[model samples]
Target: MIGNNISFLKGEGYDFCELKEYEYGEDVKNIDWVISAKMQKPYVKVFHAQKELNIKIVSFLNGSTYFGTKKFKQEVITQIASMLGFICVKQGDPFASYIANETCELCTKKSKKIFNVNFMAEQLFNYDVIGKNIDYEFITNDLFKKIHHKSIIFLIGDFFDIEKLDLKLLSKKHEIFAIIVRDKFEENPSELGNVNFNDPSTNQNFEGVLNSNTIKNYVNKVKENDHKLFSHLQDNAIRFVKIYTHEDATKKLIGLLK
Candidate 1:
C-alpha cells in the first residue's frame, strides 16, 4: 500500500529532482538516450523519488501552573505526546518536539544515539510545567529555518490568546494540527458558580456569576474565536481541530488522520 501511494505521488510529479545510477530496480523505459550517447555509457534517467507521508509530532506543553481545575494540561500533553510519538515510531515516522520551555529535539529510528518514545515522554514530563512563556513568532521563524521540509506539526495549547502566534509564518511550510485543550470550567467560567477567576498566565483575577446569558455569551465567544482560527487553517490548507478535556482526544485524532 505504501509503495502504491509512492507510485501515485510520482505519477502526479514532485518539485525536486532525484539521482540514481542505472539499476535493475528502475523502469528501463525511463532510460535517457541523449545522456547514454553523450557519456558513451549505460546511464538511466533519474526521476525524482516521492517521499512517503512523513509525520512529525510537534507539541508545546504549556502547563503554566494553572492549566485546568482538574487534570494538569502538562500531564495530558505529555501523555498524548507519548502516545502519538510511539504510534509514529511504530509506523516508521520521525518524531520531534519543542516543550514549553523551548527545549527542542528530534527523534529518529536511524540515529546512532537512540531517542525513542520513552525518551521523548520523559523530556516532555520532566519539563518545567510552570511559568514557561511562549514566543510564537520566534518559534515559528526558527521552525521554518530549521525544519525546511514539509511536515505535520501538532501544536497543543490552551490558546489563551492569539497574540502569541504568527500563523502566517508557520502556514508557509507546515500543515498545522492545532490541538486546543480546554476544560469545562474555562469554556463555561460561569459554571464555577459565582467565583473569582484568574488568568493563568498573568495571575490576574476577576469575579463572575453563573447567569444563563453570561454562559451563552462566553460559549459563543469561544466558538467564534475557534471558528476564526480554523478558518485561518482552512485558508492555508492546514489541518486544525479543537478538543475538549472531557472528550476522547485519541478518537478525535484518529478521525482527523483517517
Candidate 2:
C-alpha cells in the first residue's frame, strides 16, 4: 500500500539529476528535445546515483504508547517502522533502528536485508515499556555523537516530555522527521466523572474528578504543549507528522514524506 511513498527517497538510486551533452551510444529516448534543439546538439538527461540515505528509525517506547482505544500506539509505531524498513530494503539502502527511553539500545544494525527490518519491528512491538520514560536529552546527545554521518532520522513517539526535548544541534547535521503516534482520546478527552489517572512514564497514579474543568484544562494543556513543540520543530526546520491510533500509518507517512 505504501509502495509509492517517500517519492523523494524511493529507496533506490539512479535519479534523473541533470542534463548533459549526449555522448555516442547514449539512448536517444533520454534526449531532452527542447534543450537539444536550443543547443543545436543532442543533450540527454543524465542519471546520477542518489546518495545512500542513512535511515535511522528512533522509537521512543515509553509507557504511554501501551494504551489505545482501537490499537496500541506501539503497534502503530511498529507498523510504520516496518513500512519504512521495507522502503530501505527495496532501495538497497542500509537502515537501522534505535529504541530510546531511560536507556537506549540499537535495536537493529545497519543493513539493507529484510531480516533486520522485521527484527526491528518485532523488537519494537514486544518491548516492555511499563516504567520506561524517554531521556530525550540523552537520546539526542547520543544520536548526535554516535551517528557521524548525515542521516534521515525518523522519530516515532508520543512526545510527552516535549519540554525536555531539544533537537537543534541534531537537526543541524541530520534531517529529523517526527512521527507522533497518539490516541485521539489523549488529545480530546471526554469527561469520565471521577477517575484515576496514571502517569505512564513515572508510574504514578492519582485519583481525581474528571469533570468539565479537568477536561478543559487537560485539552488546553495539550494544545499549548503541541504549539511549543511545533514551533521548535518549525524553527529548526524539522519535518513531522501526527498519526492517531485510528488513522492509517502508511497513508500519514506517505503524505508526509511523499
Candidate 3:
C-alpha cells in the first residue's frame, strides 16, 4: 500500500513552474485569473515535466516528547520521520534531516536510497532527549544557508515552544508541513487529588491539586495555546496535522498525505 502511494506521487509533479498562455489541451483549472485579468487573456501555469521533490525532516527530540500515555512522543516522531524518509527515497528524491534537542545537527547531503534513509532514521533514534532550549533563530539561520533549493520540510515536534517570527521566516523559503506530536495527558488531565507536575524542558516542579476547576483550566489553557499555534501556521500558509501518541502514526500520516 505504501509503495503504491509513493508510486502515485512520483508521477504527479505538482510544483508550478511558470505562467504561460493557455493551450487548448491544457487543463483549465491551472488558469491563473490574476494574470489573465491583467493581460486580458487566459493564461495557465506551466509546470516542469519532471519536478524535483526534496524532502527534509526536522525532528525535535526534547524531554517533553518523552512523556506519553501509551507510546512516547519521541517514538512517534521517529516513526513519522522514517516513513517520510522512505517515501522520499522510494520516489527517487533526496532525503535530508535535521535532528535537534539541546543541540542541533543537519544532514545536508541528500540521500536518494533506502540505505541512506535507514541511516538517517538510526541517527534520529539514537539521539538523546534531554530537555534543552530550542534556538529557533540559530536553527533557521543555519537551514537557510544550507538549503538553497525550495523543498518540502516536515517540522516534527511537540512544539511546546516556538517562535512565530522564526517560523514565518522559514516558511518563506520552503514549504513547511507541521506534524504536531501530542500526548493525551497533556491535552486532557484527569482529576487526581494531589499531583506534582514537572516541566520536561526546564525540570521545574509544581505541586497542585487536579480538581474539576483545575482540570478545566488546564484544558482551556491547552486549547488556547493550540489555537495560537494553529492560527500562526495557517496565517503563514503552512499545512499542519496533529498526531497523538495513542493513535496509529502510520495511518494518520498516510491519511494526511492523501
Candidate 4:
C-alpha cells in the first residue's frame, strides 16, 4: 500500500494494494461494494494496483535572512507547510518535509508518535532565518534519492538567487512543483516615489531613484524574468505556481490541487 501510494503520486507507475477490508468506522465513501458483491462475501474492495496514492509532501522553505520582507515569506512557508501536513494526514498520506538545513522529518499516517499540531508548530517556530550557503542541488538530489517511491514536492522560495536549476532529475523521479513567492512592492515601486531598496537575503543596499522611468524599467525586467522562468519550467515539464504575498496561500493551493 505504501509503495503504491508513493509510486502513483510520483508519476512513476500505476499500481495499488488492497486496503484493509472496510472497517465499520471507515467512511462510507471508501467502501468497495462492487468488489464485495463479486467476492460473494462481506469483503469491501481494496486496491491491489500499485497506484494507491500515498502522499509524501516535501516542502523547501526559504530559511534565509533575506526572506524577512514585509511579505513575511517565512510565515507563508510555515502556513503552507502546516496546511499541507494537515491535508496529508487527513487523506491518510504519509508525509515528510525538508528544511534548508537538510532536516529530513517524516510523519507516518495517524502516528501520534510521529506528528501532531504541536509537533508541526514546533518545527515552524524553531526555524531560524539564517544566512547559509545552501546547495539546492544537494537538497534536491537527496530528496530524489531517498524518495524511492512517488511523492509531491513543493519547492517554495523567492528564487532570487538560484542561478540555474536542473529539474529534469526531479521531474523524472518525482512529481515536482515550484511555488514562487513574489512581492508587489518589488514589482512596481514607481508609485512610492523615491525609496531605498534592500536585498532581503544579503541585506545589500540598493539606493535607487524610484522615478517613473526606473519603475518602468524594473517592472519590465521583472516581467521578463517571469517569462523566462515560466518558459524554462514549462519546457522541462515541471509545474510552476506563483503566489504573491498579498494573496492567500490556501486559495492558491486549493487551486493547484483542483
Model 1: clashing residue pairs?
none
| TM-score per candidate, chains pooled | 0.70, 0.84, 0.77, 0.68
Off by over 4 Å in 2: 1-47
RMSD to native for every prediction? Answer: 6.6, 4.4, 8.0, 7.6
Q: Which ranges in model 1 have alpha carbons more than 4 Å from their true place? A: 1-54, 63-65, 101-115, 191-194, 205-217
lDDT of 1: 0.63
| Tens digits of per-residue lDDT for model 4, 51-167 | 434345444554452453465666676677677777766666556665653344452232322356447656654666554444566766777777787667767666554545557
Q: Give candidate 3's error at residue 108 in angstroms.
A: 7.0
Give the RMSD in angstroms, all C-alphas superposed, for model 3: 8.0
Q: Judged by lDDT, which candidate is best?
A: 2
For residues 83-131, write the lDDT of model 1, one tens digit per residue: 7776665655566666543444343332212257778778766765454
For TM-score, candidate 2 versus 4, the one ahead is 2
TM-score of 2: 0.84
The positional error of residue 104 in candidate 4, measured at the CA in angstroms, is 8.2
lDDT of 3 by residue, 1-258 (tens): 122222223223454557889978888888899999999999987654454577888888877876888988988898899899888877777778888665568743577778877777777776667666566667777777777888888989988756432577778989898899999888987888898888777788989888999989878878877888898899999888899998988888887687
- In candidate 4, position 16 carries an lDDT of 41
Task: Quantify all predictions' global Cα lDDT against the true fold.
Answer: 0.63, 0.87, 0.78, 0.61
Per-residue lDDT of 174 in model 4: 76
